[model samples]
Target: MTEMVRDNPALARFELGDGDALAVAHYRIADGAMIFTHTEVPRRLRGRGIATRLIAGALDSARARGLRIVPLCSFVVDYLERHPEADDRAD
Candidate 1:
């Protein structure tokens, strides 16, 4: 769908959607790394690939920022397993 995911720095998350339908990938930046801690897609929004797009965009943003990725969230870890091309970015 080419949804435009954006980083909400004040909230420490990569966000997609607006208002009550928001989907987010939460993270913390430290020591040149972006540590992903959680991901959430509204129940109504599940099964529509929203989380995939959100994570992909978040990883891309971290790469652009020259930050390594630390996927602490189970969702992120699973994403890495499913997308081996992203392996190089994770620690």
Candidate 2:
């Protein structure tokens, strides 16, 4: 399992196993939308679904704040493309 924590504004951190796996998604609030700039899951952690979890958590956070999402990150864009349900909150 992976652990996600909102470390601060515009950032969320995720971890898996005994390693410090991190997914860094950049965001900015504008016009009631959470404009996601980019997201990165370390190369070593790729294909493990950590990025998905991280994006999911970020979307959940946006939903909680009544904000829409604009997935600018290629990884996030690809993720949203596959998970249509998450696009409901996208701007």
Task: Judging by TM-score against the true structure, name the best candidate.
Answer: 1
Worst 10 residues of 2 by lDDT: 9-18
Candidate 2 lDDT, 1-91, residue by residue in tens: 6355463673443223317655577778878888877776688878877777778877888888888887777877887889888874453
Q: What lDDT would each prediction earn against the true structure?
A: 0.89, 0.70
Residue pairs with colliding backbones in model 1 are none
- The true-versus-predicted C-alpha distance at residue 5 of model 2, in Å, is 4.0
Give the top-scoring candidate (lDDT): 1
lDDT of 1 by residue, 1-91 (tens): 5559999999999999845699999999998999999999999889999999999999999888889889999999999899988764544
TM-score of each: 0.91, 0.79
Model 1 spans with C-alpha error above 4 angstroms: 89-91
Clashes of each: 0, 0
| Clashing residue pairs in candidate 2 (N, C-alpha, C atoms within 3 angstroms) | none
Per-residue lDDT, model 1, residue 16, is: 94
